[model samples]
Target: MRRLGTFLLGVMLLAGPAFAAPLAVLVEERARSDYADSLPPEGAFEITVKEPPKGEVLTLAEFWMDPRSGKFLANAVLETGDVQRIGGLALITLPVPVPTRRLLPDEIIMEDDLTVMRLPVGRVGAYVETEIEEVIGKQVRRVLTPGRPIQAQSIIHPLVISRGDRVEISFSDGLLALRSPGRALSDAHEGQEVRIVNLISNKTVTGIATGAGTVEIVQ
Candidate 1:
């Protein structure tokens, strides 16, 4: 009896979590004005869900949980119509189709059999909300949510260049040139910061000449 009780306790501990279902949620359809006076046709608008598991449903509350948190943090009202008949079982999936007209700023639109509900959006399991707000009308607004955050280490532009600076080019041989606004100079003055553009390879190189007509190509 003692061994049986210990075995039963262990099975209960392991099975408890398996019986708890994850909170169901869906991402509401989002819509934005294109800055035109006339509204685009209803069918012309669409919202794309980003990040997370690609096929996971987008729901108001689920969108708020920071994925890094590793906790399912949101919930939603599921519609019977959105439920699918799979092998005689109802299965819920990501991106249950809702109409485009229901999305608002910080809100997600969901559909039922009779009407659509626009509810405040929330984060999903372990995910944090990173939505941006934009004004659409005198009193209307919209939210722009990015799929992922931009990393600080990603290079977007050249870091070492500045405007109105000299660029130099050196040839494999002892030839040099200076490139400036609207002109190129082959005979550059010594110790002058010069700019050079390679005509063959179409690359720009820069350096200060050590002497007059003595520019040597750096291998």
Candidate 2:
């Protein structure tokens, strides 16, 4: 391997001048705005030169580019007849999840409820969860259908205490404890505040949800 590498280096040194040519490849600025699912059109690039290579032909190849960022990949090809040069650019994409079926209001989301999709970096919204783990097991906040992107506002933590259920109300300050039965006026998950109507007195009060069908009085 060492002898073959030395021999190749010598050949390259001898032929260095023959391949020494000056060339410039520039992607037009509009490419940044024109990127999408399709490759950037040929008109999105411009090549400039002062003089033609000495008895050499310039060959410029089409480039594969990301549609979202209008940036090309390292596969770009540039060749100069008398002066040789090459340049490359790389772009990144984002992986996002979309609902595979209709999610109704009050329904809980599950792992099989969504599908992963690849989107151009800029097309992804900041409030959207990029992975399924962040979305699955959450309760749907409203109606969403197939192909709709999942947003942070579209879901919520599974409710430990849902609305209208009979729950045990407890009041405590660490030293003393009191317990009573109450009716929840609204839905609340663990650690969330909710309204309850004391069953005996019929008085409304707000309390923190502590467990399934349980609430702790704030005062």
Highest TM-score: which candidate? 2
Candidate 2, residues 82-179: lDDT per residue as tens digits? 22222343333466788899999778888788898766555567787777888888889978778867878889998988789999999999899999
Model 1, C-alpha of 183: deviation from truth (Å): 8.7
lDDT of the candidates, in the order given? 0.29, 0.65
State the lDDT at 39 in candidate 1.
28
Give the best candidate by lDDT.
2
lDDT for model 1 comes to 0.29
* Per-residue lDDT over 69-121 for candidate 1, one digit per residue giving the tens place of the 0 to 100 score: 21222232122112111111111112212223433343322222112222222
TM-scores, each model vs. reference: 0.17, 0.59
